[model samples]
Each structure stands twice: as C-alpha cells, then as structure tokens.
Target: MMYTVIDIETTGQGNKITEIAIFKFDGEKVIDEFTSLVNPETYIPEYITALTGIDNSMVAEAPTFREIASSILEITKDCVFVAHNVNFDYNIIRNEFKAIGLEFTRKKLCTIRLSRKLIPGHRSYSLGKLCAALNIPIEGRHRARGDAQATVTLFQRIIDTDNSEKVFAEFLRRTSKEATLPPHLPSDIFNGIPNAPGVYYFKNKKGKIIYIGKAKDLKKRVLGHFYDKTDKELNLCRETADIDYELSGSELIALLMEDAGIKQHYPEYNVASKRNPRAYGIFTYQDRMGINHLAYNILKNAPSPFITFFNITDCRTYLEKICVQFELCPKYCHLQEGVQQCSHYKIHTCRGVCINKESVKNYNLRVEQAISFTSEISSNKIIKKPGRHPDEEGFVLVKNGIYLGFGFVENTEQIINTEDLEHFLIRQKDNVDIQRILKRQLITS
Candidate 1:
C-alpha cells in the first residue's frame, strides 16, 4: 500500500502552513521525500517560534503556499495521507487549497487512532509523549521533518509486527464509513435514527452535547438537516460526532423530554435552552371582595400558575383573547387599570365587574371558566392521547388537581379506575416547563 506520511508546522493561529515534510512509503521502504518552508504571510508568535524553532525570518525567503500548492498535490496524488492528528493537518491543507479556488479531498489515516488500537493503554496519546514511551528517536522535535520521521518509524513498527497486515485490514474496515462522513462528524451516525417521536442530541467526538431538538418523526427531522444548506447547519453537521436520542411514545412526551434535556444540558446550539425557563406566567388570586383576578407576571417562584409562557407579550395577548372569549371584566382581570369601569365594559365587551354591574360571584365564575383548561384548581381529569401502538391508548393522569404522570393502557380494563391506571403509569416530576407543555397539549386537544 502506498502512503504519504506528512507533518506540518504552522503559525498556530489560523490555517497558515509554514513548513511541511512528506515521506512517501510503499509498505517496506520509502520511495521519495519532500520538505520545505513556506511563507505564511503572517506573523509567527514568539512562543510558536520557540517551540518549532522556525522563525519568521526563515520562511521570509521560502515559497508561499500558493507557489507550491501544485507540487504538494502532485506528490501526494493517489496516496493515502497519513498524519498523527489527521483532521487538523488535512483540514488545514484542504482550506488552504480552497482559498485558491481548488477543491481537495484524499483518503486519510490518523496515526493517533491507529496507535490507540494497536498499542493501547498509554498514559498520553500525544505525538511527543507517544514517541518517547515507545523509545523512538525524534530529532528536531516540533520541526516538520523531525515529527514526520518519528511518525514514519511508528508506522514501520506497526507494519513489522506479525499481525500488522491483519490490523491494517481491520483499521480499513472500521474506518471505511468515516471516509464519507462530514468533516465535523465521526461516522454514519444518521443510520440508526428511528422514524418516531423523540428528542435527539448532537455531540462532538469527546461526547460533549452541543445541540438538542425534538420531533414527531426523528428520522425526518435529522434528514432535514442535510438538505438545509445553511451556514449554521453546515457548521453543526461538521462538528457533530454522533447522534443520541430517546424514543417517546407520544408527541407530548417528546416535547417534555426535549425541554428537560435542553434545560439540563444547556446545549450550545439550542438557543432556547440558554434562556430562563418559563419567562412569564399567567397567575390568579382572589381579590378582597371575593373576585378571582388574573394577571401576567415575570416567572419567579410563582406557585401553581394557570399557564406559563416564554414571552410576556404572548401571555398578555392570550389573556386579552380569553377575556373577550369568556366575556370577563377587564378591570377585575387587571387588563385595564385605575378606573371605575373598563373601556371594554363601556363598549359592552366586558361583563362589568369593574363597577359591580356584574355580581362578584358571577364574574369570578367567568374567570374560572376562561382558564378552566389550564386552571391549577381544575378537577382531576384524564387527557387521552394517541399511543405507541394502535390498540394502546396513552393517557395523562391528573389526580386531585395535581398532574400525577402518564401511561399507556392496553385495554378498557387497564383504565377502569385511577387505582388501576397507576399500575401502568410512568411517574413524572412536576415543574413549570412540564406543566406548560401539558396544559398546552390539553388545551389544544
């Protein structure tokens, strides 16, 4: 097998390649070699100079990357690119090529991954540390030629072992899928996603979650990503190493699970997750004359609110709509301020609790009716929704005005009574976010 072992020294700031070394090997021996310093067209930091010992003065007279791009491509033609951390070097080269309006792609093998598989259990997998642990002699340390030579020796060791060919075959088989993977991903992570309701997580290679989302059909949502073609979506696809998911039996469960996961993980790409939870609430309290008043407030330790909202504007807008729908008094509901009778009452839109034209008892009852769907004091109820299977029925149990949890009942006998239903329920913690999702589902249903 033909392989081009490469190492590069950069400005350590951007995609600038200052010096590079390449050794073309054909299994048993090195057939050719190339080494050069290229002007990076940028200042080299003092610390980087101290490490690689390649000062700005050294590259000042060398060929620029644009001048040598053709030669670099010519030498590596039809050869597998081999490097310690292949992604870094490969990306740098590809990006530099892109600047000159050229597209570049090549089969690659990372020695870091290979070493971990063939020579396991090292304290550190860094190039310098690995070479030292293996007792391989390295000259010039951070210099391109020195590191490239060490990598060559390491490659030779893997080849010299009795099981070397088998290991190479296995490595090829394992990483074959990775060749087509997006630059930001690890493998064919999209393959296993199911076409079901759920929450999905996007994680980088180290398993750090960076994005979270939910969908009624997970496979379609994930596939939608590939067709988006937006810069953000492209960046997400590039960095995503894997896709993790939880299958929910119903849309309500998916919505609740997504909110909980986003709150817990605070994923970088989930804009809503980074914001405060349930920013606004629709609250109700009894006035002095025994009238129930409804108002909107910033959500903070407000217990048993009627409904929650991410925006105060939405809460106020919904409140107005509810007032009109239920013929509620605007003054008593706090939608109109500091008046004997609200404008709605004069216009005959409100029932007139503002001036006591409507009795307090009747006005309070209307307020209760307005928010009955989401009222904290509503009677115990069951919200029946579609289940995972056609014969099964999913149900949310609210016991004594508190949301108990949800479950799927296989038959009428399984849900004959609350006591019988508890046997199949998956108990869930009650929180404002979950309550909002539950109430919204109930109201819409």
Candidate 2:
C-alpha cells in the first residue's frame, strides 16, 4: 500500500504546526522524503525550543505551511497518512490545509495505538519513549523530520513483527464489517460506539442497566466486548436486545455513574465491585487510651460517606506501602499500632511512632497525610475541568460539605461564585462512588 508517514512540531499552546515532514513509501521502500520548517506565525514557547531544539528564529525565514500545501498533496496522493499520535498531527495538517481553502482527505492511523496492539507490555509507547526502550536511534526526538524518519523505521519493524493471521484479521476489521459476529446484531454495532472519553451503558432487552463502563476510548472498549472471548460477554451479546448510553463528557463522570448504576441496578451479568457488603474497605487503628478511632473503623457503618477501596487486602497493602515510604507508623495508621515501635521502626522503615518516639501529634498527622479520597471528607471545595464540548462546562462536585456528583455549567461565573454555586451545578448522589470519582479526578489533575 502507498503510505506517507508524517510528523509535526507545533507551537505549544496555540497548537499551530510549525514544521512538517513526510516520507513517501511504496510498501517495501521509501520513494522520497520531504521536510520543512514552517513559520508558525507565533512565539515559540521555551519548552518546545528545549525539546525540539528548533527555535522561532530558525523558522523566521522558512516558508509557511500554506506555501507547501500543493507539494504535500502530491506526495501523499493515493497514500495512507500514518504517524505517532496520528490524529493530532493529521488534524493539524488538515486544519492548516482547510485554512487555505483546500480540502484534505486521507486515511489515518496512529502508530502509538498500533504499537501497543502489535507489541504489548512496554512501559510506554510514546514515539521517543518507545524508540529509547527498543534501542531505536532517535537523534532529534521532537523535530518533524527526525520523528518522521523514526516512525517510518518503526512502521517497517511493525510490519515484520505482525503475525499474518492477526494482521489480516485486524486489517479486515478496519476495512469491513466482521462476518463471524452474530447475525442478530447490526452490521454497525462497531460503528455505534463513539471515540469520546465518557461513560457507556449497555442495556439489555428488559431496558435494564446490564453493564455500565468507562473508557478513555469509549468506542474501543464497547467494541472490545463483542470481540472478547470471555464466556460471559458472549452470553450477554447473544441476549442483548438493544443498547443505550449517556455521554458523560468525562471518564470521571462515567466512572462515578458506572459504580452508582451497578449498585442501583444489579444486572444479572455484572458482578465486580458491586456495592455488596464488600463494596468499600478501610484501615482502622486504636489510640493510646484504647479508643477505636472512628476514622479507622471504615465500613458501611462508618459515618463519613467516603468510598475508598475494593477489598481490605488492597487497602492494607496500599497503606502499608505508603507508611513505609513516608515513615508513617503502621501503628498510628491502624495497620500495626501496638506496644513498641512496629516492626518497620525496628527495621528503620518507620520513625518509631509505634514506640512513642515520635509524638502522637506528629504520628497522627502522618496517618492523616497517608489518607486519600477523603478530600470530600475534609475540604469543601468544587472541582473544575475542561468541558467535553466547546459550548459546555465540565465539573465534579463537593458541595454543602457532601460529595455531590458531576455535571456541566454554561458560564464561568457560576463556578467562580461560591455561596450560589452549588445551586447551579448538576447535582448527583453524594454516594461513595461519586466520592471515589472526585478523589481520583483530583489526584489526576
């Protein structure tokens, strides 16, 4: 197949393509290579200069991207445009072409996703990162020409590595509908999913929430179930009458609803992390006077509606690891509070809070530090994030000292105003699931 592997370097915030390189390949060998530094018509940020080593001064006299549009079109004719993070680069080039009243049409593929699919279990699949991990020579990590060259080499290796059967199947998957899939389902079951990051609901024949899921790539995850070899999924697909979904605008919102929906409607097919007795877990500790800290005794009974963990073991394991790292006494943390400094203090892992060496004041402070997802428990604050659509706003809430849910607001002033703000936000359940979502969203942000 004819291919043009392209790479681009852009002005950071403005996202204006500053340089572009294209390598034309006819299956086996490269026919030609083209590289150009285009005047971004904006100030280059310092970080971009440090990373790409391409300065604004260098592109000052170079031709603008508009000047090379025809050349690019000629080179990429009858070719699939391929790149690392192909969508970002392809969109930038397409947008630039559109600016000059030219319509750019090309099939596109992302090598980052391809590499992850083709070669699994690498720590990272970033173009430069994968190059380093695989010992691929990358002299110019961020520049257009250099990255383009690296991608061509990487694509060459991918073709060599891909199994004939799997590659053929994947190729067919992209090009046509699957013939092996159940005839009862629509040919466009795959096409039904959207690429946006959001929550997806799978409703069964009874109009019940059979399954709720979240994905950074919603389309990929939903389609994956159809292709999944799991026995349960196969059974679910056989019985599914129709599908319904709510676009959450964010995975955080999706996850919050996924958990809530699962609990609210215990579908026959779904089981993991259901809000049964084992829904949440907490680590508890006793003070010097033998008082069981209500903080430690977290379960369905615990008053603060903060949901933290899937299992007790997971909670213990995570807290133990954190305690050792931060020198937090396992004793004070309700993990191992006993007579003398815990085993960790003797082993030099802890600062001897268990042995009364560090003041309980300091030890208690450390214990509090190790806690999380309780920001909703501690701080009464509203969270703001980039909206899903250009016209909307996105948010997760902690309102009136409760873990309110996520929603959209139209104006910035509503979020900025404190006392009247809670009235305007899309209110959701202050349940443990929402609390978990809020906590995770904060940590990620």
Measured by lDDT, the strongest candidate is 1
Residue 5 alpha-carbon offset, candidate 1, angstroms:
2.2
Give the distance in Å from residue 167's predicted Cα in candidate 2 to where it truly belongs: 21
Clashes of each: 2, 4
TM-score of each: 0.57, 0.46
Clashing pairs in 1: 184-238, 184-239
What lDDT would candidate 2 get against the real structure?
0.67
Scored against the true structure, residue 271 in model 2 reaches a CA lDDT of 70
After TM-score superposition, the amount by which residue 352's alpha carbon in candidate 1 deviates from its true location, in angstroms, is: 24
Question: What lDDT tens digits, residue by residue, belong to model 1 across residues 76-179?
Answer: 99988888867667777887898888888788877776675567777666788999999999998999999999999998876776776776676566445433
Q: Report the number of the highest-TM-score candidate.
A: 1
Candidate 2 residue-wise lDDT, 164-196, digit = tens = 337534634555433223223334554676787
